[model samples]
Target: MALKINKTAVKEAKAGDKPQELRFEDGLILRVQPSGVRTYYVEVARGKRVRIGRVGTVTPAMAAEAAKRLSVKVMGEGVEAVMPVRAITLEKFIADVYEPFVEHEHRRGKRTAEDLRRSFADLLSTKLDRITSRELDAWVRGRREDGVKAATIAREANQLQGALRFAVERKHLKVSPFDTWKAPNVPQGNVERYLTTQEKAAIRKALSDRDRQQARERASANKWRRERRYPELPMVADHVMPMVLVLLNTGMRYGEVVKLEWQAVNLTTRTITVVGEKAKAGRGRIIQLNDEALKVLTTWRALTNRTTGLVFQCDGEPIKSIKTAWKTIKKMSGVENVRIHDLRHDFASSIVQRGGSVYVVQKLLGHGNVSQTMRYAHLADEQAAKAVALLDGHKRGGR
Candidate 1:
């Protein structure tokens, strides 16, 4: 029955077998449940109902006030106007807005965009505003449960946070959900893989065997081409071995090496310039080439017969990947559990073991900070001990 609803009427409301609705003017309702729990609801329109709060929490006066305001809003501005502020879904925002901005702004933007999309796949469908810090914690816990490395998880999380921050900057979001999120601690002393002497020798032998095999294959193909009167291909048909040598010697990142152009190479100075745009450090640096590296590049340059364009290209296009070749090389060499990137680590380790300072290693590796080079500090410690032992030998001679 419709009646004048007040605090006393709401407080004294009783429940029976079914829910009892105490209706009032202006479409305000106090619903009393079977267990005697009362909640305030408002029928802003004829069929639509909106829950305000419970009776104890939302008093009759407050419910009445809210109902009146909602009614007035619906009458003047329509139902959509009274609805909560809508936010775009995370996936939609990233694909439509953030990614496009990143593509225009950053060199590796496409890769970064793809990584974020893949990493935050679970949260893609969720609305941006609904993604709280608690939600991120659950996501991180899920990743941990899936056995994803802490460092990898931290990197992906940071990328997602960066995308959200970009959204806020572009006015697509009010604030980033990850603004207060703390990344899980990554073990700083986690040592990188350094190839052993036997492994190194095995890899070199494998490369030599592979190069000989390739030479024979090239000769056979050239003979077939000559018979068909087609143009003979170059001796250096692929970039796999030469690129590996450069990576091992120069400690150049895969991207930097792939993007390297002939213009940056100085045969006289035996140095190669890593352009800032292609470099991870965002600043250009010159890398001095050792005898093996200089010879490899010199032979590669002569064989390819190119004075300009990418150092590693296939059919005049940049080589996308050498995964298959690297895998084959590893298998042939019996080198287990070594990643292609580990060659860079091996390069740094060689210097450290030879008593080169971490500061020098940092500069050679183009690390923005010395802390990155500190992962090889243990190797330096061994070198330091060896140096100190030489002083002991000198003291013995003096005695």
Candidate 2:
């Protein structure tokens, strides 16, 4: 039965064998359940129902006001106007919208999305609209307190800023809170580490020593196994020597070298084509093979029985990690400070020291920008000096 619902009538209402509802003006309705629980609802002219509150929690007057506002919204008076300003928690938007869009529409990899999630995990529960420059500053300060390097923190902050900007673009946020924020200051130039000639020789000697010791152990085990007195020993595969040589010569990143396939290498052309997917820049690059690099590849190819697949592998599969081995090798070789990436630096440094142009080094290193290649500029100072010397009046014969 339709009636104007008031507090007195709501209390006087009885629970029926089934559910009973009292309808009021302006889309307000008081529903009386079989258990005698009364709830308020706003039913629009279009028959869509929106729950207001419970009978005791919400009075008739409150329901009437909500009903009026809902009726205006249903009439298209200003319904679409308020959606953009609606605030959502950062966690909800990232999970419901941002991640899906990044994974599907943006064609970003799963790992990239996962990294972003980890970077912003602390702020996930905060409301998107409530985030401010001060919050971002605190986040940066926290990262510094945790001993993260400025460069790493800056990269993570840039990624977070990108995500916030995406939220603004999707109308999930009115504006990016981090739009005015500044990332932690990073060092202006790259810190290049390279191996000296003596250090390089020491590393080679260490690798050679390891190989000889393993070979002897294998030979001794074979002799004992043949005599039926001892179990056969497994032969150890040596990859460090060749891998180090390739990195030192090619200037390819460790990831690129490990993921290299046989098909990408052209011995006849004396070149390696680092594919776009494996390359850091997301673009393929050609690396010309020098004599040392070519020799290493030839030697490694002949040693392996597999005709196809990765150029470097363990148990016929691509190597997953070489950290432990690299650490041991570095310690034994007395090259304590050099990292694996320094081999690439060594390659570039070697080229520039030999009078190679910055452009040439940039091309060889597959750098997307010349600025990355400019760290080796100091190595080319002698070439610049020689050029200036050619202009000396004493050196030139009346030129």
Candidate 3:
């Protein structure tokens, strides 16, 4: 029989020869053994019981409050929330708890989750307490052997360490194993590749040629469909070419461009507003569109016939990736050892080479600090020379 458990009821409860059970309204139970010892247990969910404490250790009131807290914590953080920290494995924590929480809280949570899975595949099954500095050192050494760059290795390690820190914050672990591990040093302002003038022209030509080819293919397919009395395909231009052009011209990150809504873009003002939530730095900023970018956007908008919703979408949905088209563009352009990210470096390099200030470049690229933009300072060699030349006052064949 169950009762409304209280101090008097709990105290007056007698034990039998066998274990006697006293159930309460809030899933709180007092189990009395034959020796007259009482212990508290809380049922967080169906058939899931969590031990609280003994009666002499914790009063009925204290036990009930603890039970309520346990139930609430379990409801919010899942069953692992109540489990001992050492019992949870790194993989289980990521899959069962961390991933779901981040997926709800962050825009790039899915990607972050995928990165963790791929980067730490070998360590996923290891328990949190089992992860040691020696293991991490070996992993870093292995990555170096595999020809991974120090920066790439550092980024991946930091992301994994972040997940471990989150576990500590959530009380899922006593401490993060990464707390003692030193991350690989990443060089500052190491700009790897910037497109040359000829390369840029070749890429532009490739994009234009791809668009024309797409149009021809669509036309031929539509003609066949018309002859067969089938529905004709829409002749709208694709988002890849225009999106790449926008990235190159605006120096906007791919994520920012993909999530960009029409409401954020002011065609009349020739500007784009990167929302704070979607921006990498968690702060919003405006990007002034260049003549080439403006024209590309205008043509794309006209072709798509959209004035609302996402600026670049596929079948009325936000685009996931442009990898296939990007590969084709690279092959067609005959450019070697260039990545999509290099487009942004090229944009910054061009600005500095054309006498644009570091401050202006920082603002355009939405960098958090001037130091990040200093990679292009060397590219401003000619501009720097001109500035120094002004110190001489009236350059007449070097005085």
Best by TM-score: 3
Listed in order, each prediction's TM-score against the native is 0.55, 0.54, 0.56
Best by lDDT: 1
- Cα lDDT tens digits for candidate 3, 220-314: 99999999999999888778789989988998877688889989989899999998888865778999998999999899889888889999987
TM-score of 2: 0.54
* Superposed model 1: Cα runs more than 4 Å off: 1-191, 221-236, 390-398
How close is each model in CA RMSD to the real structure?
A: 13.4, 12.1, 14.1
In angstroms, the error of model 3 at 388 is: 6.6
What lDDT would each prediction earn against the true structure?
0.83, 0.78, 0.82
lDDT of 1 by residue, 72-184 (tens): 99899987566544489988988898889889999988888877766677788998888898888887765543335577888888888888887777666776877677765
In order of listing, the candidates' clash counts read 0, 0, 0
Candidate 3 at residue 193, lDDT? Answer: 81
